[model samples]
Target: MFDVKTIGIIHTPYQQKFGVPRQPNLVPLGTGELHLIAPFNHPDCVRGLEQFSHLWLLFMFNHTAHQGWQNMVRPPRLGGNEKMGIFATRSTFRPNPIGLSAVELHDIVIQDNCTILKLGSVDLVDKTPIIDIKPYLPYSDSYPLAKASYASEKPAIMLTILFSELADQQLLLKPQLKDLIQQVIAQDPRPAYKKKSLSTQEFGITLQNANIRFKVEDDIATILSVE
Candidate 1:
């Protein structure tokens, strides 16, 4: 049997999974904490970890259950309509239910009270269990001359942030807010391919005790209100 053990816990701002962004790096300043567990907490484990600016995480889809396996899946990118081979897309529902995310390691502070790794650009839900961590080695990891397939294609639209004066001040101080919103919206959080005869319109997405309503006009997104 192939046994897997969780070595750490990830504390993120995302409490729900309904509208999570596709990639972590897209998050502007999305912040979180990486709490390492004991045994892995031995000082030796942390050695040479500080040299890298980012790390790759392999984790489990604890919230989801396996229902055998499907050779094909309906992806949100296709407006939840078209079916594609599961290997062609990165849907959370899978045979193995494994999840991988790349996150920025801002700092690893070993406090007497607790040892933690402050992080950025996390697209994980709160209290996600992390299976393992590996530093990003540019030599083996980077591919300057790589094809991104369908992913390389940009979305037909873009996300814009228009914050109220109160939110503006808050964003300036904690820029992570802007990044967080972008990460959430950029994935075209709307229902995949819902046809409404409109390319530009206004909508809202909830986050951290705030309701963000935005409008898309002139191909530019305008933050309409925050209530």
Candidate 2:
């Protein structure tokens, strides 16, 4: 058996999986920080990391790992109706329960002797356990001519977001979160089945310490409140 160790934990605005972007860099406003732990927190561990503009994060699916896995899964990209081989999709349910994401590396900071890597356009949930980190080499990683069957293109921003008076007022206290909130909601965080039909059901997601509630009707997502 192979042994793995968590070098750090990533803190992102997504407190829950319900609203996290399905893929990295989908929401450019989404930002996070990786706080290295123990021996890994030393500056020598990341001596030349700052030279790279992006990095690849190898993280564990801590929340879903306990649920076990199956060989087949329904991919949200296929409207959650078609079953595909687990290896064929990016399902969190897997034998290894591992996930990989390429995120923009904004900066590396040392605060109170703790090493932290500031990241942008991340898709990881809050407090995600990171197993490993590697610099992203665009020359070898980028393949513009590559084709993805179902996810050939980036998902479209399906909904128009409108904030309520209360939400607008709350934004005054945290103006920095306004752009993040709009970008997240614009991608339409509803389930695949819900996206196939129009419903008046209200939805809520926890971003940072705020509880954002909203509803979708006729392709318009109205922010009901921010508590």
Candidate 3:
């Protein structure tokens, strides 16, 4: 048997799984702080981390706990296309319940023995337990000719933003709303195989409890209504 321990807790904006991006890179602007807990705070443990542009975060799915793991999981990209083994997918439910993500490292200021991991491109849920960290060596991580068996090719995509004509007189230019909308749409919510018909259809994501619905027309996505 192998023994394991949590290095620290990762802090994220999401308290629940309802709206978080499926992966970290998908939320390129999300902010997070890795609250380095005691014991793992030993400076030697995090030595030389500042030299890397990005680091691989190894964390645990403390919220998505599973008992007697399943062998297959349906990836959202496939829109329930086919079943693949747990090992082949980054599903939260697996025999080990571990996760890995390459996140941009914004800063690494050390306080006493603790290292404050300031980061960008984070999409983890609040208080997620971290197991380990490793530098992402570009020489080995990037492969220009690599093949993606599931979703390799990038497709032509477009989006729009139209605010409600009835928007609050004093809230028409709220920065948070724009930030939220940009964050939500950049994720490309539509299923991979689905046709790009959002040009005239309405769709939305929950923002600050309001359903920020909109319709994409031509190249402009109009925020038809907010409720």
Candidate 4:
């Protein structure tokens, strides 16, 4: 049997799974921090990692615990109608529910006897357990000619997001985060089945400590409130 230990915990604005982008860098303004656990918090462990501009985070699907695996799984990008081999897609329900994300490295901070990694455009949810970290090597990682079987191109932005007076007032406390919230909503995070529905249902996403409520109607998403 192989043994893997969680080296740290990743903290992100995504307190829930509802609005998180499926892939890294998709939400350009989303930022995160990795807090190294006890023994691994030693500065010597991550020595020289700052030289790289990006890092690959290997983390476990802690939220999917106790879920059984399936040989075939549906991908959201396929409109949730088609089933593909589990290996072909990055589904959360795998034999080993481990996920990998590449994020831009911002800086490293050692404070209060803990080592923290500042990262940008992180896709992992808050409190995700990180198993390992590796520097991203562009020379070997980028494959311009490589074929992406189904996700050939990035998902298109489908909605125009507008903020209400109440939302604006709440956003005044952290105006810099407006772009991140807009980017997350523009991707239309609603489930595939709910995409074209005209129910005008208001959805809420927790960003940082604020609860943002918005509704989509006729392709326009308006922020109704933020608290």
Candidate 5:
């Protein structure tokens, strides 16, 4: 049997998965930190890691564990109208409930007796277990001619957002939080099957200790409140 150990845990503003951006770096304003566990928190462990601007994070989908996977998955980018082989899509329900994300390495610091690595544009859930961290090599990782069948082009923002008075007040208290919300909503986090449907249902997303409610209508998303 193979043994895998978690070397760290990720801390982020995202308290749940309902509103998480589907891909890493998609929400450039979102940020997080990786707190290294004992034995792995030593400075020597990351001696030359600071030279790289980005890193690859291998993490576990702890919440999705025990759910079986299928050979085919419906991709959200395809509007859930088509099926692709499991290997072609980044589906959390996999043979192994693990995820890989490329995130910007902002800095390494110590606070409150803990060593942490500050990350930017991270698409992981709060408290996600990190299995490994590796420097990202742009020379080999990037392909100028790489082609995707249906996802070749970046998705465009299709909706306009309006914040309620309560949300505006919350933004004044925490201005940095506004960018995260704007970018996430612009991407439209609804499921592929519900993208074209319309309803009066209010959707709520939790960020840090604040809750945000909004509704979508005719390609417009209006923030109802922030509490």
Candidate 6:
């Protein structure tokens, strides 16, 4: 068996899994910082990394690793009705619990003696343990014509987001996060089962320190509060 060591910890606006985008770059405003640990926190470790536009993050699903995995699992993209092989879907409940994401590299900062990577379009939750980081070589990594059976295209924007007067007032305190909050809510972060049922349920997602509360009615989602 091979042993893996955590090289860094990622800090992001997503404090929990409920609101994180299923795929990276889905929410362009989403940002994060990867702080390298002890031995690997030196500037020499990330030298010449600034030339690349993106990086691939190999991280662990620490939150759900304890639950273990199964051979067959339901994917949220399929509306949670069909069963697919665990390997075929990007489900967090994996045998190894490792996940890969391609994130846009914004900047690399060396402060005090630690190395930190500023990232954009990140889909990871806060305090995610990073196993490894590799430069994303576009020449070989991207395939514009690649075929993804079920997820061939980007998921459509499911809801129209509108902020209430109170929510608007609260947002002024953190104006920079407005676009990020809007894009996240527009994805309709509801469970597959909830999408199928007709009920007035208010949902809340924690981004940073604020709790964004909203309700979805028909194709529109109204932001009730941001506290």
Prediction-by-prediction clash tally? 3, 0, 4, 0, 0, 0
RMSD of each: 3.7, 1.3, 4.4, 1.4, 1.5, 1.1
lDDT of each: 0.71, 0.91, 0.70, 0.90, 0.86, 0.91
Q: Model 4, poorest ten-residue lDDT window? A: 193-202
Given candidate 3, what's the lDDT at residue 212? 63
Q: Give the lDDT of residue 73 in candidate 5.
A: 95
Candidate 5's residue-wise lDDT over 41-149, tens digit each? 8887888899999999999998787887999999988889899998999988899998999999999996565779999988888999999999999999888799988
Model 6, 1-227: lDDT tens digits are 89899999999999999989999888988889999998999889999999999999999999899999999998988999999999999999999999999999999999898899999888899999999999999899999999898899899998899999999998887887878889998988898888887766689999877888998888688999988
- TM-scores of all predicted structures: 0.77, 0.96, 0.74, 0.95, 0.94, 0.97
Backbone collision tally, model 4: 0
Error of 2 at 215 (Å): 1.0
Better of 3 and 5 by TM-score: 5
- Name model 2 segments beyond 4 Å from true: none
| Tens-place lDDT digits, model 2, residues 1-227 | 78899999999999999889999888887899999998899999999999999999999999899999998999988889999999999999999889999999999998788999999889989999999999999999999999888999999887899999989998987877887888999988898888877668789999887899998999899888888
Q: Whose TM-score is greatest here?
A: 6
What is residue 153's positional error in candidate 2, in angstroms? 0.7
By TM-score, how accurate is candidate 5?
0.94
Pairs that collide, model 2: none
Local accuracy of candidate 1 as per-residue lDDT tens digits, 147-204: 9655665454444545556556555655655666666665556555543336777776
* Model 4, residue 182: C-alpha shift (Å): 0.9
The residue pairs that clash in candidate 3, if any, are 160-221, 161-221, 162-223, 199-216
- The regions of model 1 sitting more than 4 angstroms off are 66-69, 78-81, 153-157, 161-179, 193-227
